[model samples]
Target chain A: MARNSSLVFEGRQTQLKPLFPEDVTQEYVSWLKDPGVNEFLEARFKKHTLATQRAYVRGFDQKTKFLWGIFDKKTKKHIGVITLYDIHPMHKYANYGYLIGNKKYWGTGAAQEAIALVFDFAFLKLRIRSISTGAYAPNVASVFNYKKMGLSYQGTFKERLLYKGAFVDQVWYGITRDEWLSRRKKLAF
Target chain B: MSTEERIKSIMADSLEVDRTLIKDNASIYTIAQWDSLQHLRLVMALQEEFGMRFGDREIPDLVSFAAIQEAITKKMKSHGKE
Candidate 1:
């Protein structure tokens, strides 16, 4: 529907942009369905036929879940995905998620750039009061990434997710708008 | 005895690993326990030991021991400790 405008969040050496339908169909779904890639993800979509994939992308755009395709400005490659889901307009808050889907880009701080962009949107544009997210307690990498974005661990949700025949505890974390503004000392220009 | 050795001690302690494993250029990603939370702890430890604080521009860049050393060196030089 193209309801939203193309917004770019620039970092020291990277940039973030909202994902268009074209990019979603071309790359996003394939990346998501990769077994090794989707290991940490809870829901697995079956059989992405041409029609199904197209419909999936369109459906995603229709939701309030804003998805951003992360790119490395230097290489101009689509490295990962990040999203602000479960948006609460009245409360000015959302639940967020991200993944550096590309193995080559892991440990490169590109995810951090994507997160900084989300922070920019939440605090600078949307005026969101808080953003919350949860990670499987065993997913150390995701937990580490969240904390790096200044999110404080709230608590553990015991057996919150059943994945791969086992119930996984979730560690919930969040950062308030006021806390973000106060902690943010660098205005990356 | 040397600046490098002192830095290694700090790294070993902060990372909660063997001193011998902490090379001169070891980074947070290279160590298991040196994740983001530990990263913050390391920064605070350095501040306490050196009696200094880092500005926003430097925190993200302080991922490696070499980077930390450079930051500390710069702070020291600014204070005329070098």
Candidate 2:
């Protein structure tokens, strides 16, 4: 089995399972297209149709990137999406991203659980040296979440991305496997 | 000084927030520095000061200043800190 294949990650107070084919739906795609939802998509993925969402979800696997659908165990509801993208086995690292689409779950530590699980996968299973991520400068929540995950701020790239109609900077953050190992118990999901 | 006083001092310094803002019943998420990373740092700081270690259960329960105080008190008692 691949790392995190059993889809049984214990989050802070919830659980994270692999995103199955069934999780893909027009409803989710509609949310993906909502301006409020895609505000941080960086223009390229801002306007995803159901078909595009389907393709994106279908492509996630051991071959491409790992995607997981976050869930609230107590409420038993889907809370968000998280993925380890740009997985490079040779370099032993990947890019991480997640969004708690259900605003109701925002500020509830559900995202924290999702993030902790991602780190667990990256450091324990993949044996990656480091995981990298960037938050669009305007996405304060994203930046806050990454910082909470113990990622160190690298720098900001001005006009790094074009979203909607204007260019925006992206703030980079990264954490190494050694850091994860040193702080694993404290950051445990 | 009381353990609570020491912890509040630590919070005031590390979180860079007003000590008055911290309440015994406040949620851990209320503080800007009570984040995940800072939570770890807090645990390390507390461990160094109090000469104690925290388990996973203690971590989840240590979500607030009061919670940390409670956990530390419990540990201190069990270890004969008095």
Query: Per-residue lDDT for A149 in model 2?
Result: 65
Report the C-alpha lDDT of model 2 over B1-82, residue by residue, as the tens digit. Answer: 8888898877666555788977776544456445544556666788888999886334534667777788888989999996
Each candidate's clash count: 0, 0
- Model 1, span A36-109: residue lDDT tens: 77777853636655556556555555356677778888888888878887888798888888877777776556
- Residue pairs in collision within model 1: none
Report per-candidate DockQ.
0.08, 0.04
lDDT by residue (B1-82, candidate 1, tens digit) is: 6666776787788767899888876875456456554565676778887888875335645777788888888888999877
- Per residue, candidate 2 scores C-alpha lDDT tens digits across A10-80 of 76577787776667766666666667766786424656776667677778874458888888888868777
Tell me how far the alpha carbon of residue B66 in candidate 1 is from the true structure, in angstroms, after superposition. Answer: 19
Stretch of 10 with least lDDT, candidate 2 chain A: A41-50
Q: After superposition, which runs of candidate 1 have C-alpha atoms over 4 Å from their true positions? A: A3-6, A25-27, A60-63, A186-189, B1-82
TM-score of only chain B in every candidate structure? 0.87, 0.83
- Model 1 scores what on Cα lDDT? 0.71
Q: How does model 1 score on DockQ? A: 0.08
